[model samples]
Target: MDNPGSQEVDRIERQESRAQDLHLDRVVATQPEIGPTPPDGGYGWLIVVSASIYHITVPSLLTLYGLVILRAIRDEEHEEEESLKIWDMDLALVPIIMLVIRLLLESWCRAVVKIFNMPRFMALAGLCLTVAGVLLSSYSTDTYSNDHIVNVFAGIFAGTGCALTGQQTDVIITHYFREKLTIAQRLVRMAPSIGNFLAPILIGYLCTVYTGDVIVMIYAAILMQNCLFLASYTRPIYIEKVIRTTYNMLRDAADDDDEVIYSNPNQPTPAPTTQNPQQGTSQDDDNDVVVFNSRKNAREILDPAVQYRERSEPVNNQARFSSDFSAMFAETSSNRFSSNFGSLDVINYTSTSRYQELESIDRDSQNPQPLYRETTVNAPQNNIVFATEPTAGTIRRTATLKKNLITIANMLMDINFYLYALLHLSTTFSILVLGVFFPAYVWLQVPSQTIWWVATTIAMGHGAALCFLMMCLVLPQNINEKTRLCAAFCFVGALGFYGITISGNRSFLILWCMCASFSTAASSILQQPLYNSTLNEFDTTATITTTNAIVAAFVLTWALLKNYEYSTCFLTAAILQAITAVIFFALSFRRRR
Candidate 1:
């Protein structure tokens, strides 16, 4: 009798304390989830600038190797006889080596991006290797007594370096410039064309006025400058959503029908399914009905306290998993990265909102328990921001690998892939033949004025390369227009090269050489549009590999038939180009039909 009133008051006071705890816990658990901002053009443009520097320097050095060696050999009267033996045959392999390295290392390079967790670091490393290779070649060329040794070492080092640096640059640029991708690519490609245009003039001047030492030194300095630009590529920005929580709809044992109970934390989840109107329930109600009915029918479920415990327990499990994953990966405390290059403070509140809904469901059933955990997802920023954890990154990369393989497999089945491949093969073969044999062809046929014809042919070829770049830059971004131009140019190129094989007149040869140069440049330019139209990256890779293989085949075949007359080589190039034009026209016709 003395404490009955006090006991009743104490019971009410305890209930009030529990309710306050629940409210605080709700606030904590419902905290917003922050994520990385999407990439728009701020620091991304900086990447384009850096890539352009490398584009200009590296390809200029690479593409000019043949011309540089030829000029050196011709100028060195003492070595003129030996030059043909050492320079001509071996120089053909440089582009082949570089392009093959690019073709083979595509998968390995993609892995490097995932494993390093920092593309900028990988890019810097590649730049360093390129610098080292350039220095080694420069040193060897200056000191080495043997011309063969100099060409061999220089080609190996320079080719390897260009391969490494060029691949990384392409990947970085493609990652950053999605919105104005066409314009960005045109700018980057233009750099190489500019390099090709200028490299020959530079080499000719260096050989005629300065020495080989001075030429090699200049290239090393240019490549070193490229390193400064590459340093700005700090980190990669991911566009896809992070913090995905999947929920699976398990079949109900009683009904033998699918029910999304939302009971388990680890179950495989499908996206929200469509609601059945005949049930007179919304999608949300349909999802929870199974769990609601189970709680109502079971005696164990009647205990409100036990039901609350069940719901909170699952949430706690999820929180732990997320916490562990984040900690393991050394990511920002909140799954999002707050970056200066893009918008910040943006949070994906789906997880928080869903948690609150689950908590409310528990409360509605008249079940109450202590919200034991604070459930605060600590929001700390990182200087080096990556999109995912190591495990998640690995899984995603593995999945991407599977997708690439499947896509490649599908392309193998597609007739269009082979058709395009053949067209690229023959066209690229023709284009490379110009660089490989045209200069030599001019030197041989017009020996009385070798210097003039060689210089003019090289100038016109690179001049056409520059013009092609400019056209792609200025033209409307219409695929049909590009296709029409490519066809017109290629047909003209075929006619010119065939004429070159038969024509002996010096003036006519020069004119036809210019025509072939323009057509080859235009044909090469068409590849950019073709790759852009492709649905898969692997398909682009396939086209590149096919083109390189065909070019390599031509180079090796030429080496085997070294005894063949120069005219025979020119005739072969013309035949291949003519075939390419036919295939392209046939492909275009089929597409129209």
Candidate 2:
């Protein structure tokens, strides 16, 4: 049955191969790959909640560090020895090389995830490399080559952990609530603020108390280990369902064989064509209807995106089982009757299931190389191809840039953006009042010497957050989602310094903060809508990522070069942000051809 299509035949002989995994038994026992429909007992939500518990603490600390800290660090270290000045004080006293090491680790972590089967080993290797970097850096007495101290331990290890876990966190949660990604992201972004709003004050208090870096390092190390404990809760779910689906697809393909046995008249005997199914079957539960049906059930399960669960009354168990029974019965017949490789076993979705699969290998699948070789672009799945059509549940995927869910997500995210700015603004004004006009001002207690610590913390925060967002966007399916979020994440990094100016009451700082906010607001307003409206995740991902990166980087970089000072730098950024916002607004309103 060489690629048999539209053939009517009997006694199909099919065999398929499957591979090793840590949770093969769970795969065999549970209907794990249960389908687009929400599964019963709904523990996926529980996992989502658990994952968010950890993720909520990550965002803020990464996003806005440099805003309040950088100006003081560089100013103090300006005339210092080269070794002391090697790293930007505002960037967490992290050497320039540590920055490079971090970027490398970010990419490597993504590489590991796309190689899904190798996650355990790859993650371990990442951990080793990171810890080693830290261990080596311990010998550094000065900042010149301090990156060696940063190499394996904190930068490499933490970078890898951030990239891998951040993306995995999204993927796992998305599996449970793909439709709710934007909302979930908005909620998760606040986690950092919750954890870190007090962290600075605590650091200040501790510094006042201990008056040394040693206790600070000890406390920081303890915090990092605690975060690792939270990380342990994250893992892959529903993997077995994926393996089972692949297995059955291949099994149907194997059914294609010679229908006619060659007759040798000179031979002593002729062999019978039909082999007994009962005799050849394995000792495994191949004969069990429930076992075979579970995989089929997930595939056959009507997507809740289109057909949601019945809400009027309690969902009838018998009715669900009945629906399950019918689908399995249909699949059994299809498999049993197949005489060719082309006879698909997909009961309701054979057409889409096959065509969609032509491109649907995981980013990590060993044999299939990525289509966009330079960029790690994952292909579409068979189920998703068919499901891609717009419906109420999926209408957000079809909305225009302004109308899409991503746009809404961006808008919702602004709640935090605005709040963060406002908080910083209040802090800045109070500080300015103290610094410029009156020494008696209470808020003036923030201290000029510790300003470097503030600035460096903000820089480190922005870098860490931006790196996290970038890797997540670039690593998975529908690259557009990643890109959109990446750009959104990068926005803060671009304008971070302005917030500092607003707080300090420097000559230009006020204008800079205002403009920076405007620019970020405008970018989000324009870019997110386009992402929302576009259908092709690839097209959206590619277009938005490139566009946002180019546009956002240019604006931010120009601002940086104009003023590297606390007051003037931020003030300049504010003007640029405002101008960028105006340009974006004008473009957004213009009539398109």
Alpha carbon lDDT of each predicted model: 0.56, 0.37
lDDT of 2: 0.37
Check candidate 1 and list the clashing pairs: 35-336, 247-269, 248-269
* Over 4 Å off, model 2: 1-35, 38-42, 45-111, 117-160, 210-216, 219-223, 226-238, 248-530, 534-563, 591-593
lDDT of 1 by residue, 1-593 (tens): 56999999999999998898765323222112433332546778888888877777776555445554454445554332222332334444444444445445544565566556465577767666656655554533322234455445555555555655666666766656555777776677667656666666666566566555566677677778776787787654342122122111122344453344554343344446567778664333321323543433432112344456546652343432232333322223322222232223234323333234443544466754424112212223322222443698899999989987887687677655654555465555565556545655665555555444466566666676466447666755557734445566767777777877777576677568667766665565566676556424455655555545555565556645565545665576677666666666666655541
How well does each candidate superpose onto the true structure, as a TM-score? 0.58, 0.44
Runs with alpha carbons beyond 4 Å of true place in candidate 1: 1-40, 75-95, 131-156, 236-409, 426-431, 436-440, 448-457, 481-485, 496-510, 534-570, 591-593
Residue 156 Cα positional deviation in candidate 1, in Å, after optimal superposition: 4.2
**Candidate 2 residues 516-572, lDDT tens each?**
323233233233333444323333333333332343344334423432333343344
Clash total of candidate 2: 38
Q: Which 10 successive residues of model 2 have the least lDDT summed?
A: 434-443
Best model number under TM-score: 1
